[model samples]
Target: MGKDAKRSELGQFLKARRAGLTPADVGLPTDGTHRRVPGLRREEVAQLASMSVQYYTRVEQGRLQASAPVLATLADVLHLDDDQRTYLLELAGKQTPRRPRARAQQVNPQTQRLLDALDAPAIVLGRRMDILAWNPLAAALLTDFSQLTEKQRNYARLVFSDSEMKRRYAGWERVAADCVAFLRMEAARRPGDPRLRELVGELSIEDPHFRQWWAAHDVAAQTVGTKKLLHPLVGELTLDWETFASTTDPDQQLVVWTAAPGTASEENLAFLASWVTTHSPGEADDADARADPHAGRGTPPAS
Candidate 1:
């Protein structure tokens, strides 16, 4: 969509969402007099967000793009949860999806082998966090990749759309925002890819949070980070991850997750390995297919 059309759509959506709220919803005191607007006035929003009324007006009018920090402030003022915040951003074109071209090679066989050999959970993922290839350990720890279609194997999609995956994450809110920021960074790196674009579009339409977070224009590259996972079989584990670029493809990264030695996380990892051994591949595949990533998980009940 053109900038104007995109902006207008987002503006209207925000307006409608805002109208549903009262001053009390955001801790503001209403005068209880005849008010011209359904929601907080532009001046009230600007005061709460610590911005100028003109700037807030520009934002609501879709005449200017808001930075990540500014968007965060606006989200706070609007009492936007993760989904609403993300949808607002997407509507602003602050973030565009990755669009992968069919002609491009997303992953190399050698890299896939490297992932398979890693004793710990590891995966070769594309710029958009697509599971190009994941080792048995990674599949066992998370979801079985064999069951997911090439299109449904995205990390971002799983975070927001899959119930099991969402439950696995300790802080779903932080994970969701990080995914958006990371994807934004990837988009800057691979602007020509059609798969990225399609994924972004699909997600934007599917979740309001994705749309709002996408609009914030945040960029992040956390190649090495810690993720807290609540494994169904093994309890909670904090896994440290490291990402390395594939030798053959700069766009592909090998992500590996490891835990501290002699810790409870190590014990959990061991348990995950055993789960993979007992569960039949046929059973897992059927379950994952039913958990399609593009399918919408309706905006989580406010907060």
Candidate 2:
């Protein structure tokens, strides 16, 4: 989609939200009058929001531009959630999704060190959820990102296009839907990003679910969450993941996945690390070796 489509996005988002609510839902008295359209009418929204019906109609029709404050008011009136409100305001030009500097291609050395120090799966993601880097544990738990092309090392790409990814997740459709929502949030944050545009276009063409989910206009930000994976090697792992943003790079974030201390999941993680050490040799060793300077190096020369 282009600039015109941006207007369409804003309009559709508003209409979708409105359609999701009813007169009773918003505490409006039903006059027993038959409704022409679903949800609250434009007049009711305008009245409750303290705006003119004509203005609200124009805004919904994507004909007139409204101020950020005005859009914020509408967001409140619509009872938008935090993510939804942010997405709505972003679409209304209250924020710039475009980066002032170049989109990040690499993570800082300190960040990489942090990943190396972790005992669990860790990954650094750059703009458009590209797999910028990952710890060996992550490589073991997830696919070996090192073996993939740059274009192929994307979260959305893998979740949608890779057959193994579908089987990896216990509930593939929910995970895939969330991936689409995350991409939508990123796309809103950086409108008309060519690379982002290309990613969406490709997924829309090749994947059936991608097209529908993308069209849903849902937006989501990564947060503390739990993921259940059926690992081919170690079996089931229910990992908890948390996402932390980089202060230097807004588009860069670190995601760490760990299992509870004494659960079977944690034991499986240990087994996975061992499997990596055995198969890849040095890429993933025991927990202490993860902190060692030469964790995976060969035995030292005899003195």
Candidate 3:
């Protein structure tokens, strides 16, 4: 569907959901006085969603793009079911229905545990390609994420801004192009996300390469692939990569890098793991701090 039509449909859906809900249904005090409209009023919905009545009115009129959190809040206030909640997010151009307390960059404990358990390189990525968390192997394979500032931890930013990343990836142009395409896909899903816009804006200004690729209008979903990297420690290595989406939070993905058993790449990975184990713990940490001077700074909210 066209963007305008989709927005209008989203507005209609919101209105319909609101109309089906009564003040009592949402735990609001109700009087028996005659009402001009059915269900909760616009101001009531705004109040429940913690937004301004004028803003809500503009959203219902299809004149504003509602953020994922706002749509999720409205869905809850309107008592929407799971399917309805998904629909609400889809209509709002969001990849997933965000819970009120859910932060896009926060990885669940279970996911973190899984990352820690992995023998190979693994990283958790948000919808905006921000590196939320990474395993020790991931740190060994790529740059140590903890050493980079949160803003610098993003895949797109590293691909464009870090000269070391360009040198690490053997197919730099192809990898950089794919990152741009995947970002384009994310842009379509969350068009109203200010963080995404900011990331794109910063990249466009900083890198002419990013500007050219973004203007190509390419769009791609992250999936299984093979990446050839020239790691400083492990030397040239080809690893198979797979992306798995989180069932609970569709915006979160676990990207794993592994090598085929009995291959030279596998042996190299094993060697790298052993090297990391034998090295002084403080050495890696110190190296990371030196690599990126601005480490430990928090990232901006992805929403």
Winner by lDDT: 3
Going through the candidates in the order shown, the clash numbers are 29, 1, 0
Tens-digit per-residue lDDT, 216-300, candidate 2: 7778999888999876656678899999999978778999998999998888788777666556522332222223322223332
Model 3 clash number: 0
TM-score of 1: 0.59
Decoy 3 TM-score against native: 0.61
RMSD of each: 12.4, 11.7, 15.5
As for lDDT, the candidate ahead, 1 or 3, is: 3
lDDT comparing candidate 3 with the true structure: 0.77
Q: Model 2 reaches what TM-score against the true structure?
A: 0.61
Query: Which segments of model 2 are wrong by more than 4 Å?
Result: 1-104, 281-303
Q: All candidates' lDDT scores?
A: 0.71, 0.76, 0.77
| Higher-ranked by lDDT: 2 or 3 | 3
Clashing pairs in 3: none
lDDT of 3 by residue, 1-303 (tens): 888888899889889978876554443555559989987799999998899999999999999998877887787667665677878778777897344533546898999999988898899899789999988888867776777887888998888888767776888999999999999898767644556766876776687677777777778899999998876555567899999999978888999999999987898788767766656323433343234322221221121
